[model samples]
Target: MVAGDGQGKNIDDLPDEIILNVFSFFSFNELIDTAQNVCVRWKRLAHDPVLWRDKEYIIRGRAQNGRSCCGVTCSECAHCRCEKTDREVLRTAGSMPQLRTLTMMRGTRARILRKICRNCPNLTTLQLHGCQKMNYSLLKYIFEKCPKIEKLIIANNLLADRRYAELVSRLEHLQSLEVFENRRGAGPVLLRFLADACPKLREINLSWDYHPLEDVEYFVKAKRDTLTSATVRWTMAGKRCVVTVLKEAASSLEKLQLHLFDVAPEEEAATFADLGELHNLRELHCNQLCPHRPRLISLAFQPGRLPLLQRLHLPHATGLPDDAVATICRGCPALRELRLIFATSLTDGALAEIHRLKHLQILDLSGCSGLGGCAMAHVAQLPALRTLLLQYIDDLTELQPSLRHVLDLEQLRCLNILNSGHIRAVPFEEFAVRLVNLRELHVTYEEEDEVFYKNVFAEMQSQMPRLRIINTFRWTEDDFLTDYETDDDGDDGDDDIGY
Candidate 1:
């Protein structure tokens, strides 16, 4: 393409920096398969290490893509689809010697990881997810190869023993560490290692259970000045660690998530009360709340308290009243996202207060059974609102009033109304007409009405060609019995249908 100047200069006439900047937008796959073959200059620019510094190469498996099993490697195996992809990834990783981050997903072979590790010496972040039985030797090999790694995440993977901690402690440059799962072997020993050895650690997310309160408190206290994000699961016996986190890391802590097992009513109340002073908090999620609910109300209800909070997730606010919601909305002026999932006791009145949140963009009121169609009027008033989730909400009938309110949301991009039975053909058609800005829509239908709604969805898709619609069918009790009905030969017809 020629530049629109009098000289009619071609793209190659531009400086190498400008051409490389343009090349940066292309995906690694595009760079390898297309750009590299485009021209000599383009290929050379495409191979620049600066482009791959933060590009995370994801290596996922067939199970992740909804398959039973990825192909097995036979003795005389021609490379399977997965094997081909792995070979491509290793080749790409080898080219990018300055690669900073690599994410290997489920079913990643250890040999492939070891190869990538040895190639990318400047690697700073390594994330391995859902690849179970990750022994210490593999981790040790990775650490030895990528000595400059700063952020490490091993989520949903089963670890062998304490050697996981032993390997992690060697990363002197480590800043962020996340090893989250219920079935991990690491306990308080991991926390002890992090507190003692890893001085530069600023973020820690360990979802392992049975971490004693004393060890938890000591770790946070030790790194109070540097720790910016902390997610820890501790026993209920030492709930005072909540206070320690709030008090010690009050100035520096930006994100805080605490998971406590077997928490009593009074202990929950105390924990909520202690959260009043964390002024620097940007995100907060503590599942359990006091029965009184007023303790949390005070923290969020007061002016200038938790002023910088952008996201507040309270999933267990089962019986939260209207006054509490009103107070939260009134106080947290800068809140961009608020999730009050399963707050069953809330009514449409709470949303009226939420309309005051001028900067709010994402709101999730899923499982708020008490909310009806009328609440959407207030929800639609949020100017910056883009994503709204109202899954399993009761009485969201497809009436003119509700449909009109939802259509008023001109900026809405994503809407999820999963299992919301009352919203049928009329509301969706109305949405297809007015909600043109919508990019993604998730809806569910009962088994009996599936075919009818599928047709309705087809028409909607034609009207809004840019929209992505995800359809789900909620099976009825009768459908289950029909599937198991015996035939004349005493054979169940279930074998013919795939679940």
Candidate 2:
């Protein structure tokens, strides 16, 4: 029987499955305050097991002047306001017996840790961000209550003591652990404890202050067979320790990111050579190393090595020559995403070889001053390119033939041309007409007048309604003064001028 609410068809007449699916789209606050109150059937469906199985709650802090103080310095701000309290979230989560994944961000307190442990015993994934009040006791409560948790992400928190490690070691079923920006350093004892306690752990991301070389070596050696992904950002005390870890985990490691500090020149050659052994490595990100070191690139990147590699990020790698870029293109044929920001040595010759990467989806060559129009010509040939970031390219004037080729790609979603002052508005307007699928277009030309942008935007909007243009050029002092004068002239005679 189809039911009606006088004027239109009734929503209650829909089947329970359809109703539940509709309610699933509603946020937690909306379901509780509006949807559940519509009718008894809607209320029941809102509380169904399927609706609350995977819960995500974002506890945002108060904002001032439209700027939110949610994650950063929320605890320090006295005026911060949260929509739901810790106890209230626990009470709501406790009512859902089938809860499996819980992600709570910002404003999480220690008091709710025990509640989560006692309430959601079946939780397999627990992610908590910007938890200011987290401590040893709260973590212990989680270990005792949520024994089945397999993946844990506690980032930007204050808990980084020995007790925190001890509590983490208690989670016997732990498979993945990501703990970043903690207060204290991850010492040798803590590393050893984690290695011994969590034998099944396959992925670990630790961005703490320091980890002893010996401890890191031991941990890597222990998890060599099981560990597939690891991100370590710490001060380099012993370079050989890094080499040993990479050599040991060569066969199993698939993704690796290392940000080392205070690296000596004597040990760099050996360290870079060790990277070649990781045949199974897929993604490699090396950041903030000693600057102007070209030998490191030559030693590490060898042909026929890292064939399965997909993403390569080498930001801050200054003076990266064209030969190095050629070596990378030849070595990593399966590359999907490549970022060589600030690599000033690369020229058009390097980009010529990049077109061969048919599988390439994202290419970022920002700050590569050596590249010219010829390089962009090759970029236009990438069949699968989706995102192209070319900021601060010195010789990039106009996207002529390249613009047509880029518009041809149906999958090209984002194009960033910030600080590329040579590109005129006319070619861009034409490009916008054919790039119907393009979602984001970022452009900036400081020398051009506001009228130029207004005309370009108006024309582009008329052609491609869905394209989002991000204008990054800031107003000069002259422009601001001119606008003030225009506003003054528009004022009536009765308007007072305060002296």
Models, CA RMSD each: 10.2, 11.7
Whole-model lDDT values for every prediction = 0.68, 0.66
TM-score of each: 0.76, 0.77
Q: What lDDT tens digits, residue by residue, belong to model 2 across residues 393-497?
A: 654554444544555666789989888756562267566656667888888765546787788777887788788888775544422111100122212333211
- After superposing candidate 1, which stretches have Cα over 4 Å from the reference? 1-15, 34-44, 66-93, 107-111, 129-138, 155-166, 182-186, 234-241, 288-301, 398-403, 425-436, 445-499
Candidate 2 least-lDDT 10 residues: 478-487
Model 1: how far residue 353 lies from native, Å: 1.6
Candidate 2 vs. truth: CA RMSD? 11.7
The numbered model that scores best in TM-score is 2
What residue pairs clash in candidate 1, if any at all?
none
Clashing pairs in 2: none
